[model samples]
Target: MRNFWGLMRAYWFSSSWKEAWTLTVVIALLTALSSKAGVWFAEASGELINSIAFFHDAANTTPLTSLLENAAFLVGLVVIKDAGITGSRTYISATLHRRWRAWLDNRFNEALLDANHSHFHAQHGAGTPAPDNIDQRVQESIKDMTGGAIGLAMGVMAVATSLYFVGQKLISSSTEVAGLEFLGSYGSAVLAFVAVAVYVPLNTWIAVKLGGMLEQLSIRMQRAEGSYRGELTTLLRRSFHVAASRGEDVQKAMHERLYVDIDQTWGRHNIVSASYASFERVYNFVGARIVAYGPGLIPFVHNRIDLKGYITGAELVNALISQCSWFIHVMPAIATLRANSKRVIEVAVAIENVQKPDEFYRRTGRSEFRRTSQNPVFGLTIQNLELAHEGHDTTPFLAIDQLRFRRGEWIFLRGESGCGKTSLLKAINGLWPYGRGTIVLPEGVKSFYAAQDVRLPQVSLKEQVCLPDAPKDHSDARVAAALHKAGLGEFIEHLGDVTRQGKGWDQQLSGGQKQKLVVARILLQQPGLLFLDEASAALDPEGKIAFHQAIKDNCPNATVVSIMHEATPPRSASGTEFYDSVVTIADGTVIKKPLQPPLPAEITEILNRPAMRQPTRSPAMEEGWRRIARLRLKQK
Candidate 1:
């Protein structure tokens, strides 16, 4: 009950909570007033019936006339009151449901961004899906949780109202007789009161158990859907090798488990429904028998007293009506209230998990540096660095003993897949899980990371190249230069206006074009320390060489660290040495190698032409008969 109340209180702090509260208050008033009217009519009818039965010895007339008149009047009033209540309840309930759902979606969207920053990739358990795909939970689980809580609350309220009226009517007529008739009716009312104590707890327990089963079933349903969709793609693509190697029999067996889990959960729900149905049936039966027939039974037992001493048939009917009135008056409201309450709890739990952990890392305010600092010496240094997950101790994902990138240096990290190459890059950029280490990025140092697959938004060609907020005028010229350097000059030239249907960046760009656009974006960014993860793989050999030269031209003093399968040209005598230090990894161990010139055999073959060692023409120049060789020969 305390948890349920807490859930309701949480909604008060949400965006649309004030409107929800106003609607709730309106629903509550209509419910209370309608309920009061029913109770009053029942009490008035009981009084009129008692008068007729008591005056039977003193020229008593027919009691049917009074009973019919009161019944008709009460019935008419109930019709009008219920109409208003129903309309008001529908409008309010619909508003509350929609607003609450919208609030949950907003929270989930916020969690996606927040959790991504906090390194929540593996936060969901192994069998569970990623946290960002929690859309199903937000849409479905929250609805069920809220519905269950509301139903439980409204059920309690209805039961309370029914018992209150029945209890008063029974106690008032308890002294009417000394026979078994009185005992039969009064004893049943006592039993009904005791049953309320016993069955309410039992039903509450059943509901909670059923709710757990439903939540589990919902998760299984999602897993099955994802599996089915994945398998369908594999089947269409004729990727049967994976299935054949695992044995198609095993795949079918795996699917059967999901089906069985959902089946078993639905089976348990039947037991819950049966338990509730049985309790309601018994409560209604006993209340009617005790309130309607118990008082009339006493008239036959005590012959000395008039029908007044006991209760007339009309009074007995009114008492029964009062006892059963809550079924109409209170049940629906309590049900809705319980359902809303549970949804509120689920939202609160998700929000709390994402919002906490403020003590860990908060971005501190500092003035931005305009240029890269050169004060830090040109030597790599690493003090202490360690990587450990929250609950594990033995093994770690990344173990950076001590490492750093010196200013104006080119460092190459080469390693096998999953040998922590990507993880190391993430750690350097502060994207991985937090660890105990102090990374003093020199005062004006800026870092840029290009992941394996470039991420491009579905925007115009210029926007994709320059990012959304970049200046439109500057983007056009810079994008052209970057594309030309990367050998994507023809592609960009054809995609002139990104807004036109066939010419739009998103409409015409391929995977390779998108990769080139990312390089263009970075060229424009010109960060101090550029971390490239196979960034130039989309380009040809000549394009790759030009791309490297363009980086040196754009950010002359910046340090570059790259993960590459191909090596750049070795240190030259006249030209600048592109990469001074090369760190290679073969078996998870870093090997520092000297940047030596080409082998003797290769140099002997290239001695025929001096231009072979150092090309005079620009890399972007096309090959033809009227080349630099022809021009140099004529000058000689």
Candidate 2:
């Protein structure tokens, strides 16, 4: 129940709760009105049958005018119920469902990007044993749960109203039944109600017992579909690698395997559902009709009840039986709702786990990390630092007793491929919290961390270059200036986007140009501290050198840390624009080797550059602008 409320209380108690409740109340009123209309329509139609029988028996006594009135009344009721009340109820219910889904989606999206990077951890086995397959839970399961709950509410309302109508019929037919005269007074209504009550319970019991494992089966089916969907997305995301490596056969085999699992789960769920569904449409459909109408016909056949009484009794009884059979009709839907509800609750639990602070950073955890600030002279300070991966525990991967960099120094982390250079850098950046350490960053400054892969989100080129900084914050001139500084003058037109016509971003830029794009991002955002984990490893040596020079020119004051898993850190012949130090890690030991003579001229020269550097309008940049102008004119 707590788990159930975890998924419920969030929305029911949220800011939109009032509006949700308002729509719900409107829907409920319309539903009651609609159900009442059904009862009236039944009553109206039954009386017409009575009127027709009267005319047949005594043509003189029954008026043709009265018969026409009854027919007109039925037509008016159908119009009121079908066209007005039912239509309003549908629109209101759909509105409520849409609002509920939107609220839940926002909640999940926020949890997926929690403060501690637990979203990243959740991808691995940090909080849950398997990947949550959260996209399926959010997209498919949410829809089923809300839609099913509303459907169940409608069924319940129908049943409740029908029982009331049935009670009125029973009261009218209180006298002794023809064949059950021994039972005396109240035999007709009392006995029929008793028989129906007993039969419906028995039917419901059979359905529940047969569908016991359906919740688990539904969960399995959901997970199976999620797996297949995740695998399909993975195949698309890595299609470039697959095509390059010619791994189509391998990808095909994996997809087929996932599809096979889906088929196996689907077969199991269907087999159970088939037996379950048969209760409603096949068994109850025929049985309920017989039970309601068959016995009522007996009295008419015996001439104990007139045709008028028989028709009215049959109408009420049929309505009652159909309402009672709702349980049998809804057994399959109930299982699906429960399954979807359970899956949603599990996701709620996972999000709860993710929203908590990292286990290492919790106040009650085993380790403690103290962070302070250092001066430009002191650079970055670290002491008693140890780095390790989250799931791997033992001795730390790398240990640092003391390390410091001057304010404007460039450094490289050099070590073997599997060593902890990248891990150590991440710890300093706060994206990694699996280590125990004290990292004194430069006082009051924003820091940046670039991942190993180039991040080109499917957005405008300006947005890509101004990433980590909104395009709204910088004007077009400033953005173009940043691009010019990074040597991407031709890419200026793609500032809004180049992904139109027959060009894709992957097609528009080469491998080296993509690295330059990251450099452009660095120039634009201009963080006081920068950590690069193979951010430029894809570039050639000359390109790498140029990337360094661009940063030195644009962000000379920033503290730079780059990972170099290759051999020794390269130093230029001038020694003015290269790594100031190299931190090497091996065998869980730390070594900082200061590279070359102390540098001052390069720093002075960079400091002397213009306060607002202007981008020289090269011919490529001018032509790019001209092209954009022509496109805008055409748009006008």
Candidate 3:
């Protein structure tokens, strides 16, 4: 219940509260008006039937003009009531749905995309597995929540209106019966209340149990479906390796497990659905009959009315049944609303939990960055940092007592796989918070990180290079020159074409080409601090040298910290001797050493046999080299 109210307050008390409340009130008014129209129409129907009966019984005295007028009025009332319901339902529902969806999407994005919040999600697990299908949660869950809320609200209003108007009528028309003076006029309302009092407790118990079961089943089924889809997508991504290794049998077994999971979950859901449906049918049948028969039974038992009055009593019974039927209709809607509300609140709680750590930091007045002094010579300073994975109390992954990199120092970080090279980098960037650390970085320093796998947006090539900002921020000439230096000059012609619509960079470019594009991004942005984690591992040896040389030439003053599998010592006379330090991490410790210049023999061999040392280059590559030379000369 607490969680449910929290979810409600999240939206109802959001920034759009005024608009949301206005729409809600308008919808309620429309619902009330429609309910009143329904009651008026029912009364008109009863009066029309009674008048017809009167005219038939006394043909000489009855007026035909009065019958025609009643008929016309009934037809007009039906049309107007239906039109109001349709218009109000359509407009109010659409507006409220749009508003709720927009607000939820914004809040979820703000939470999930925060730097600390993102790290938390990446490190820790939500109590129940976090929702894998965020798009579905944002789109489908919000749709269900908003639509079900409106439906439940309108249903409650219908019941309230029916009871108020119908109960008043029943109580107003009174009569004495059999000298006991029993309250005959209030019989229907009293019977309806008694029936509800008897039925609601049992029905509510069953509905609550079944609704909880169904909600759990639904969550499991959705998770299974998402897993199956993810498996298929992974298969497509690794099709080549799977086919090469003849992994068809293994993949088939994995797919079968996913299918079995979905099947069992759905089977359980169907059982609960069947049980609830049967119970609903029985409850409605028994409750409606009890309310319908109560009005006629009273007068018949007491002998209070003649044959004509008994027939009139039957008409009144039918009228009461017609008005009170909303009780029966709203039962299933309440159950559905409960289940959907649970699903929505589960997602909301997950997002809130992930963001709590960041909230704590903000409340304690702790900023993400810790700066020692203004404009420090060192771009990064790490002191007594110990890093570990979340939920683990074992030895730390990488521990550094003291480390600092001055501005314009080109440093190569090398470590074996799973030796905490990448983890250390993440800790330095304030992305890993599972351990004790104080990292003091220069304030207002611009930084860029390129991971092993580059993820470009589905936008034009020009825009992708200038990502997280507009392409117009950089001059066309500078963008083209950077591309040329990064060996992507050939793609300059197709820069305007969107990298989507089946023409994504992953499909259109080779692995080496993609890495070059990442390099192009670095060259274009020219941040003061750059961290490259296996950024050039996909390229050939010559290509790697060329990109490193380009980075050195273009951004000489930037601090470069690169993580690689093996350290590549620079040649002596190639102007690639800028690397100042080499840091190697192993056994949860770091060792830093100054870079040594290449041996005299290595420089002499490279100069004597250039063709034997260097890989063959295509015309585009030659043009790229020439462009790099021109850029270097212009820089000088």
TM-score of 2: 0.84
For residues 422-492, write the lDDT of model 1, one tens digit per residue. Answer: 65566566554444454556665666777656655446555666653455546577777766765567756
Q: Give a tens-digit lDDT track for model 3, residues 1-636.
A: 127667655777877889888888888787777766765675676666656766666653655766777788888898888876748666886888788778877776676667655535523443345556665565666667667676666667766765675555545543444433464555534554555555566666667677777767776776787789879977976778899999999999999999999999889888988887897777666654655455546655776544334444444444444434443444445555555566666666666665655333333232233325337475778888877654434467778899989888988898788998888887677665456667877667778888888665567888877765588898777778889999999888777788645677766777788899988888998888899888888887788788788888889889989987655744324654757999988888999999865544544443345553346777777556555545554576
> Which segments of candidate 2 are over 4 A away from where they belong?
51-55, 60-72, 164-187, 210-212, 294-305, 360-377, 389-393, 502-510, 570-575, 597-636
Candidate 1, residue 40: Cα displacement in angstroms equals 6.0
| Cα shift from native, residue 355, model 2 (Å) | 2.9
Model 3 TM-score (2 dp): 0.82
Top of the candidates by TM-score: 2
What ranking of all candidate models by TM-score puts the best one first?
A: 2, 3, 1
Clashes of each: 16, 0, 0
Against the true structure, whose lDDT is highest?
2
Candidate 1 vs candidate 2: the lDDT winner is 2
lDDT score for residue 355 of model 1: 45
